[model samples]
Target: MSERQVARATLVVGLLALTVLVVVLVPRDVVPGGPVTPAPVATVLSADEVERAETFSRWARTWSWSSLALSIVVACWFGLTARGRRLVERVPGPWWVQVPLAVAALVLLGRLVTLPCAVALQRLRLDSGLSRQAWTGFATDQLTTQGVAIVSTSVAVLVVVGSARRWPRAWPAVSGSLLAALVVLGSFAYPLLVEPALNDFEPLPDGPLRTQVLRLADEEGVHVDDVLVADASRRTTTLNAYVSGLGSTRRVVVYDNLLDSASRAETLSVVAHELAHARHRDVLTGTLLGAAGALAATGLLGLVLAAARRRGAPGPGEPGIVPLGLALVAVGSFLVLPLDNAVSRQLETRADVDAVRATGDPAPFVSLQRRLAVRSLADPTPPALSQLWFASHPGVLVRVAIADRVRAVPG
Candidate 1:
């Protein structure tokens, strides 16, 4: 190739590199609007209750971090492979010619394969184990979150690729940085904004039975603002409950089917289980962990990209870099899925143990386990390998065994 051709090719490679960086690392997710505004009912909690809330927040943070770390690690690994690195080098083509080829490939792969797969997954209905009331809330939350992830990711990829091809080397960094920032902002925005909006639609609890549930939670040191009844039956027939929001807005949510279907003892057992999570402040704990993991993932990905760049990987106007980056993300998630689930399961087990201790009612807990098995139609004895590899929550048989032990204990 002529000298001019070689120079143009190298520049094109640089552009491709810039584009890949923006697409893979840029902050494109939605951002929470402004500061977290505590709700009106937040101040009624006692000092101990406030402490528990903080603990829950921390748990939530942890969960988020683990997922983030896994994603970054996988993404970076995919980005630095020989195929990806070779494309980043931009060997010898006119910059304009290379850009078109790269763009065409991106459109074909992303639109035809990646996007279609995501759409198919979204269309498939999964059973949500809850009453009709709780099921509605779960579906709403899941759909909202998944939609935001897909849209934001697509936008980030498009913006990065387009800008990298057009901009000069000196200016391309700006494109990459801006994309990265936007993604970060978006990630925080969606949850913070959507969570509050959903809270507004939250229905208030009625009837003496619900009131008693609230009273028990309170007596056991779970100072909740309101008990929100969700229609979770749409997702699955499983009995379940959760406590969410913060400050005065914090509420204990129970699925209606859980209350109706479970025996009185079983219902109390389930409530006690969820109440333990609330009292211990596991959500906050998970969130803190998640943030840490995300930061770590970002850092690891940057290192991988840097190493690839040193190998003369193609810049913008190249075909391989963008796909390679996305592939890395996919691989990383596959590896981390099991580990993240393990952490979550560990925390769940803790909540279960605490419930047994708190309620001192193993009979109800045992009953709760039986009902869970029947309603979810879960295998009473799932494979041990599956439990270790994929179980997010402990299996029914395992839970029942624990309850039985609790029952045998002398009060």
Candidate 2:
């Protein structure tokens, strides 16, 4: 063959390979598992279901976008408003004391601003039957979450600002290690300290389910002395399971609702998925990535604060920059959204794959995913931009297609 003909053939083959890669990565349709093409398009949702799902999706998107806007706006308002800055300064305390008090107030202010919309969102969930939580329980959870957030955030702010003031030129370097330690410490403490405040948990009673769970954990190479069950049925009817903590605290937790609602095969599939997360140390992986992101953020903060001070803005922990600092953090969060989601989606996709292989039956894997979406009122086709910025897991249809592809393969 001539050299030109050989080159053309190679190019054609390369294009075909690239096309296959795209097809493999994305599902061909909205149906769970894979395309039902050449068969008439299968209905995934009834008319009423579609209308309700759309309402839920619209409510969620509004809440998400509004929250983002409010965060930035609140930050800017505090940063610019002389009265707000003065209110923070009126509190008499040490820089440590002063910072915490101001931060607490600021946090409360943000919460108050967003609370109405939050309540509305909860009401929507309740009306849709997604949540079973009473208003009293909901209120208590909110107060608890706010209290925890204020305390943790105040400590973090102290650490960041103190490091900056103490080592102006090397603030990022000094704070990175401490912040990373805090991130890891927080991860380890969460199941013991924070989770119990929200929900009660107990060991899964001695039953066939427990036996199956332990067996799956063993097969997945994860140690599970006892699988714990959270009383999630009290707050939400959503079927779910998760793995949390590390070392001795490492355990698989399934919602009581999941056990009560899902079939034996479906339950096994969920357990296997959680075990995969623990076995692969996904939480630790996330914490490490979080630490890296903190370092980058701290570095950015240092550079910005330095520039601002040169232009006469207040130095660290001085109260004047408190609002600006919060605003900057909000912007940082917006900037990192894509990168964070990319990592999360990759991890979630792998866990889905692990669940399918561990179960060796893609049918339950596909069924469980569809059930979760239908139960949760998830958007059938979220916009691509939304997925890029916010989705932590692959779309349910994509996951189903993965199972379909796997089931098609001969052993």
Q: Give the number of the best model, judged by lDDT.
A: 2
Model 1, runs deviating above 4 Å? 1-146, 151-204, 246-249, 312-322
Deviation (Å) of 128 in candidate 2: 0.8
**lDDT of each residue in 149-245, candidate 1, tens digit only:** 5555555445544555665342234344555455445444543465454433245457666766777787789886666666555445667777655
- The residue-by-residue lDDT of candidate 2 on 1-411, one tens digit each, is 432233234334334543453344422332334442221113445566656777898898898688778877887788656655686778787777788888888888988998877888888889989999999999999999999988888878888778767765555656655776788888888888988898899999998988888888888888864588999999898899988886777778899999899999999998888887887788877776666556556655666776677777787647656777777887778877987787777777778777888999988987898788788887767788988998988777677766766666522
lDDT of 2 at 236: 91
RMSD in Å for all candidates: 14.9, 10.0
Q: Lowest summed-lDDT stretch of 10 residues in model 2?
A: 34-43
Displacement of the residue 149 alpha carbon in candidate 2, Å = 0.9
Local accuracy by lDDT, each model: 0.52, 0.75
